[model samples]
Target: MRFKSYWRTTVVAAIFLHFFVCLGLALALPLLDFEGAPIAAQEMEVVDLSEGDDGNADTEKPEPPEVKPPAPEPPAPEKPEPEPEELVLPVEMSPTEAAELDETVAEMQKQEEEAKKRGEDGKDVRPPAPPNQEVGTIISSGMTPDTRGTDFRGTVGVLVDVDAQGKIVGVFLSRKSGRFVVDQIVLNALKTFKFEPALDMNGNPMKTKRLINFPFDGSGPHPFDDDENKRMRAKRELFLRERQQQGNAPAN
Candidate 1:
């Protein structure tokens, strides 16, 4: 009987606790007061103007006046004067002055000769190589084929009148390798040459001559031959492959 009484008391206590909790929660919640002061909604104001009326109600903008620049003054008249008569003077050159004049002329001639010599000695002259050769040199000295082995042969020379910018202005076969193939090789190899230009007396760059030559390998084709396409293609492929591997791996 005592156990039964205890169990009944516990059950009744649990039911009362649950009822109290629910009732407290319901009482704690805020009440919705729909009957209190209501919010007022604002209405947009509309205005209408006649076709001839300005939109500003209290102020009107004035029209701008036309502006005219002042007139330019007339140009001054040119003045003309009389021509003067020519005058002659009975001046005589001294003996010393005459001697100096002769010396001056002689010195100029000597200078001209010296210049010519210097030009011949590779002093102020460009090489007499072909344009292509000059271009090759300017672009890359390596492009200028070497005259080493007969099998790996080429000529060495210059092209004259190469523009200051290294463009071939003229090609001269100065040091020919005696083979048409060799000569053509020199010419063809120069197509890629470029120059920084040679300077003149005034330090300004001027077109000049250059010289180059090549040798013939009885077997090898001319350097200028269009047979380098295969080599060029291989180089291109290699470059592309290198670039392809240069970046980080794409996100998987």
Candidate 2:
């Protein structure tokens, strides 16, 4: 009976201890949860405790090394636009035309030597009339220089030499236009002039001389025209347009 009493007492003590310990555990769990909530979460930072040159432990995260935006890359250099190509125009005169002129000049020189040797300079003769009332035309209707950049504009007097067949042999500039280029142009045009030969006072076609004025001013067109001159005029118009595109002046 004594032993049984002892065992019962021991069991009662164990039950009370278990109940109190369980209650304490339950209370502790709620306190732990409340203290350790997300709001109370802790962050740890490792700081270097090394002293700075000034002998003070540096704190403040060393100021993050003064970050400045990387300097903007230098703007790309702009490429210069290429210039337009110049226009190439036709040649001034053809080789064939040059050869023909050379031949004509030689024939004219021969005629001059023969005339001088014949002593026919001091003869009495009637001056040749224009082809106006005759059977042919004299001068063309316009003055054509065949080239650009002529520097003379005035009345150019010329002396023409005609052959017995009513053909033009040569032309000489009795009066110049003060510019060599202008004089040459006029001389070339005059070589194309045709007139009725002079009358030997007997109404015969004799080789003689004629004087005519070639005006090349803006006031009016020259009193001469021909197929060759017309062609040169059209070329001149086209040439000026090409010059404008090339940004250049005609050869002086």
Candidate 3:
């Protein structure tokens, strides 16, 4: 009995294993058939590259595009030349007027010739000199040395015109003293001066022009001497003292 039970259990496990193997083979059959089938090739459209769009062969190459040069610019218009204006001639003078003009020109020429002759002769002719004129002498002069002027020295030439009455008619400085003060001093002195009338050949008083020189020497001893200065100082001191005494006495 133990042997028969073992045999029956073994038969039952074998039968179950055989059913599972058959079911696995049945599920795998469609996948194996799909993998073994040959795939069909897809149909492609053919292109004829040797023909153009109209379906004809284009044997000739395309011509290069025509390149024309730029058009020439239009020329500018020329300007017109200006017309010349008409010239007007001067009117002809009458015969009498022309003759008068000629005569006037001749007269001018004649006068010019006479003037030239006179000028040439004048070169040789000496002007008549005043008959034996003598320069006037100074009778009285108001000129005094300038005490205020310091070490200044110069000479002045004065042109003095004397009248017939021994009076100075005009006086002008012919040479400058280089100092305005000196010049003014000299001029003022000359105005106050009296002159002896000039005499002609007939011994009659006559007008005359003369140049007089006035000189100032700063080194001279008129006011700058030591002795003179001391004397002046003493005099000024005495005057001041006298004035002071008088003022003091006036209190009475």
Candidate 4:
């Protein structure tokens, strides 16, 4: 019996020693880390092995994504040219007056051309004061009535430039009549005028300028301007004196 009891006691003691050793080993395993912390308490690190789509990490920046430049804008269109302007004319002279003026201008031009062909004929042989406005030629007055019911009246001063051969080379306005139609009619009529050629000191024909004031009223412009009358008087006296001298001269 003593032997059996002692054998039971030994078996119980061996079982208790085995259980304590297993528990101690389980607790000591978590302290195996050098920092004495549990394995799960430490932070775990992760690494990426991903590369470029071409399988190489340094694959030429994917060809710079094909950065295309913008296209240029189209050129602008050109503009069209402007149209011409039309003038409205007013008839201030009667049929008879117009016809007379035309005939006079034509006759004067014909006479001047004939005189020029004849080479310094006795036509412009006298040096009348202020030149031009010879005694024989009758130049029609400027500025006929504004037959239009407008009753517009103003003085239109015109500057005429006559050439050595009595041709109307140029005509310009020295003063405006403030009426466009009236001014234009005066300008056009003045163009048809011809002057007697002025004479130089040697009695040779010379170019000259004259300013004539056309004063308009209820009866259109007066027949002649002041300057015109002055020149006419001077020229008529000179012409009469020349004629008297010729008459007094002894026959050759």
TM-score, one value per model: 0.28, 0.31, 0.33, 0.37
Query: How high is the lDDT of residue 181 in model 4?
Result: 85
Q: Candidate 1 on 1-252: residue-level lDDT in tens? A: 344358788999999999999998798765656578888999988889878677877886677798999899898897787663222211456889656745644554354345345454466432233333322222223254444444545434433445676566655444456666656656666655544554443334566543333444444333332212233235445544655666555756
Candidate 3 weakest ten by summed lDDT: 220-229
Model 1 Cα shift for residue 26 (angstroms): 99
Please give the lDDT score for candidate 3.
Answer: 0.57
lDDT for 96 (candidate 4): 96
Report the alpha-carbon TM-score of model 3 versus the true structure.
Answer: 0.33
Winner on lDDT between 1 and 3 is 3
lDDT of 3 by residue, 1-252 (tens): 344358788999999999999999999876775566678999988876654455455566687899999999999898797763222222467999657745644554354345334454465222223557532333433444452564556666566667787777666565677878877777765654555666554446788754455667653322122222243345445655665777689564
In model 3, the runs with Cα more than 4 Å from the true position are 1-130, 134-141, 145-148, 219-252
Model 2's number of clashes is: 6
Error of 1 at 138 (Å): 7.0
Worst 10 residues of 1 by lDDT: 133-142
- Cα miss at 106, model 1 (Å)? 27
Which candidate leads the pack in lDDT?
4
Evaluate model 1: give its lDDT: 0.50
Candidate 4 per-residue lDDT over residues 101-205, each given as its tens digit: 556445544543453343354444222234443443324343344434446666676656666766666555556777788777676656445456665544556
